[model samples]
Target: MVTQTPAWVLNDQQGIESLQLADNPVSTPKDDEVLVKVHAASLNYRDIVIAKGEPQLPFFTPGVTPCSDGSGTVTAVGSKVKSFKAGDRVCTHLVSGLSSSSAPTFTDINSGLGQHLDGTLRKHAIFHESALVPMPPSLSFLEACTLTCSGLTAWNALFGLDGLVPGEGTTVLVQGTGGVSIAALQFAIAAGSTVIATTSTEAKAERLRSLGAHHVINYRTSRDWGDVAKSLTHGRGVDIVVDVGGLSTLPQSFKAVRTNGLIAVTGLLGHAEDQAAVPTILECLINACTARGILLGTRDQFHAMNRFIEDKGIKPVVDEEVFDFLEAKEAYRYLEQQKHFSKVCIQLE
Candidate 1:
């Protein structure tokens, strides 16, 4: 007997309104794959950009599902599957076929789940056993769903081979209170680093401080917040800067980082016009700082991050407004508004 699953597809020809629910036939897992009953999925800014058919993110095919982050229970495993069983709870990795070499590009076949292949925004999805990790027992499905993209991106920025790898007494600057930034804040704190967080409002700044931020900067009130961040560290500047704002904020990150510091360029939330500016590259060279572009991490990094989260008892800060699976479009709209403090999750069951 065949099985059917409900999913949302992005059709470039139809625009945002065309993203409607459709029923898809669930394929049997190949010898190295596993079938998952996806229970929860999370939203990211990239989803909104993709839904709007942005020219830069041309990875979506007409009928492809749209999200990379999800958590579920394993319903079946193929003959060759060794790590997971039918009853195990699991979360997916954003990219597959990643090893220590990391030689394959993002365009490689099966490299990115939501981009290069079908994603996890469905009731049931099949993935290679190697691309899935056991969910941390301390988290719910909604929270676990967030790990695949935003969480992993933060983890990779801080701990990957080219990452910052903060330790005791290290000072790190994180921008805003979004999922990745908040995850970075928590991870830095757990690693015994001093966190300097930036937010747009005082209320949000206070909230960030409550979440173990050693210092909070209101970027709105202080346009030259980078210099102010440097002042707070007594002119030495921070050891690492997690720059999610891309070009618009990169200038400030350049000012805030210490000489020989590491800056992880992770997102492009700033304006397009600002992105074209070339001076930021010169600034990085002038400051003698290393700026690395971070992608989602490998399976080994994902497993290690989970162990850290478990050991530290860290909880992912999910937004209060949880949407049902049928309200997937609404979830996207909410994320587009960018008002949510952390993760916006869609519950499937």
Candidate 2:
């Protein structure tokens, strides 16, 4: 008899409304694969973009599972899978086939999990053993799931090439209180760096301060929050800026960062119209700043970040609204509304 598990499948034509819960046969792992029984999964802005049929994303046939972040326990491991075994808690890495080289290029067509292949929105999924990382003991499955995407991107942004060596004197500017931003805030604080966080409301500003942000900017009230961010740094400017807002916020990132500071572009929250208005090359050149685009990250980096999280007792800020497996669509809807302070997750026990 074949084992089957329930999964949420995306129909390209109907969009999110077409995300139907159905049973899928559990496949036996290949020699290098591991079968994970998914316990929790989290939403990202990129998932919504893919559901809306973004042209730049890889084309998926209708019924593809759509989410890149998930955590689970291993149910079975292939004969060659020595790193993990049945009953070990683990999380899937977003990228699968990237070489473990120090200078690995992430621009390859197969760099994404949900984009190029079936993702983790299913009850049971098979992944190469190399793509699985042990979950940090400090995190629950829900919190661990949040790390696969948002957490890893934040890790790569702050620690990747041209990244910040966060310490007492180092300062970081996080664009908003979303998953990536909040993760960056926590990581930077743990590294002993002062953080300047941006938010749209006073309530959120206080929440950010409570999370160890030294200064919080209510960008809505202060339209020139960039200059204000610089001011908060005693006119020296922040050492690093996690620019999740894309084109709409890049100009300000340029203004807020000191000469030779690093700006890591990791999201596209800006409008399409603003794409054409991104700051000119002269602005970046004048600041002597370095801007680099970040994908999720390599499996090695994911493991390293997990170790850091475990060592620091870092907890991902999952929103209070928890959805069941059947309520996956509602989870997507909630993420679309963008009302949550941090990560939005679906529990699939």
Candidate 3:
């Protein structure tokens, strides 16, 4: 399905204040496409970069809608759309969806959803059947929307690469309470891995513990939080460290992950640090561990993650305040401000 939708156009790529929304039109699906009645859309750091015309990405289509992560119901399907049907629950994936074993290339991301193509931020959107995944049953549309990006990135970090899926006796280190970190914490716990999370406040630390983190370290107080995480593991170090803070936090993350362990570089939050300086290979070599940069996941991995979520009854954590469709700019701004605990979303009825 397709339509001339007056969606949330990223006008001029100036900033969040430029997001424009309209109900637009909903058309029937094409032979290989599926029409979706988008129920919800979530924001990611990449979305903000595109909306604000940040240099993180080399190309930005200014007129396109600015979000790739969404959850919706299939309203119609083309004759050739076999994987999805009318009334089925679904979510959007990067447009050029990858194979199960395929690693994403820079070109793939360059031509992906919310990048080269129009995104899934509208009330009604038509996507190629291959670019949609069945939503995890245990999650509502709001929660499912998050799985498109941050959730999938976390899943890929924990289980996707090198066949290192965290299980019993695995110790995971998560930094902050952002979407990726929180998702990693939840998925690790579900897989029976002990998790150690770092946050700024005791209040947030308590919330982390409530979410099943075995140890919560206040990074503000414990300046050497990497050593703290290592001590928590009795000097063996965590098996996996999901590092959201890039330049500022990588040193500690290096200290946290054990030798030959994995450090998933999912996000770079706070300030303009992510835009400028990044962790160097020298640091990784000195730390004696691999630091892998994650860029979401493939369609097959998305399905696998969804199955695990449904089987474990995992529900993504969304911010308490959800926005209406008209508040698209507000949602982007909220996520830009980094005030939310996990995901910030707009709900469309």
Candidate 4:
């Protein structure tokens, strides 16, 4: 029988302000469930949005266990569980529902472990064995923790949608230095594409360049960033634009991509504060570009991406600031500032 444990719960609808830590019983595995002793976890912008509360909480765990991606050790498994045993180091996929052994259909509300059910902010969690993947031996717990969300999302954009090929010399334009952007930049560079990364400040521009960006654009200085992007491409524009800032940066992004280029919409960054406009769509069509909405990728894609990162020794770009599990709220605040170049993580003991 699984014992009780303590977990952090979102106290109320004031968003991050509502997070409250409390003790709750740890659930035992029913059939294929595995009990995980979570060691590390990372936050995403989606977690922040849910913490703030919404009427339609599409797919996430409720209350205070807010983060989606985490890594841990398997301590116990249900009678029917296979593929994992005690002492296995593992990370879970974003859509826990898809991990169901019966091949989940559309009805599972808690398809994602952390979103609709309690997530890894707690010391222990009960997840289906299908939700788990062995942690890459090459990656530390923190680095592996990023895979389930941003890492997978980046993987989907490059390989799934764009069909990125190594040594292709195609140009990949990544927006800003957030988790997805940095992940995309890393993958693009590894795939032998020329990377053009945009940042709001000179400091971040320097960092982006240091991380293998072939060129860095300070969108702050170059107000007409699309023209600059086009100029940098020698007026050809880029082949792929990792469009993270959906509506706000949409117009500029449209102008930067090449004819037949692939634009993967990965995030909003407050750009989707309002709905996207028709002109943006019109312009993209005029350029003959392909636009796709990217979500966290599939399990097959996750393994593929992991193999790539592991083989290449590509470490995730992480923030210098580290937070203990108790300081989860402060970590969210830091993420909100948009100052972090990569992922903001909370370390659990």
1-349 per-residue lDDT for model 1 (tens digits): 2399998877663445757788989988888899999999998877776777676675567788878899999999999989899999999876665663353344653336765567888899988876789999999998899898889889888987544588897899999989999999999999999999999988888889889999998888998899999998999999989989886888889899999999998888886345455345677789998898877777777888999999999998888899998898888888878878889999998
Q: Model 3, stretches more than 4 Å misplaced?
A: 1-6, 270-279
Q: Cα RMSD to native, each candidate?
A: 2.1, 1.9, 2.4, 2.8
Q: What is the lDDT of residue 4 in candidate 1?
A: 92
Per-residue lDDT of candidate 3, residues 122-177 (tens digit): 87888888788899877899999999888989999999777667899999999999
TM-score of each: 0.94, 0.94, 0.93, 0.91
Cα lDDT computed for each candidate against the true fold: 0.84, 0.84, 0.84, 0.79
- lDDT tens digits by residue: candidate 2, 133-223: 8999878999999998899889999998743567688999998889999999999999999999999989898889989999988888898
Model 4 scores worst on lDDT over the 10 consecutive residues at 100-109
Q: Could you give me the TM-score of model 1 versus the true structure?
A: 0.94
Pick by TM-score: which candidate is best?
2
lDDT of 2: 0.84
Taking the tens digit of each residue's C-alpha lDDT, what string does model 4 give over 239-271? Answer: 888888877777778889899888888886744
Q: Score candidate 2 by TM-score against the native.
A: 0.94
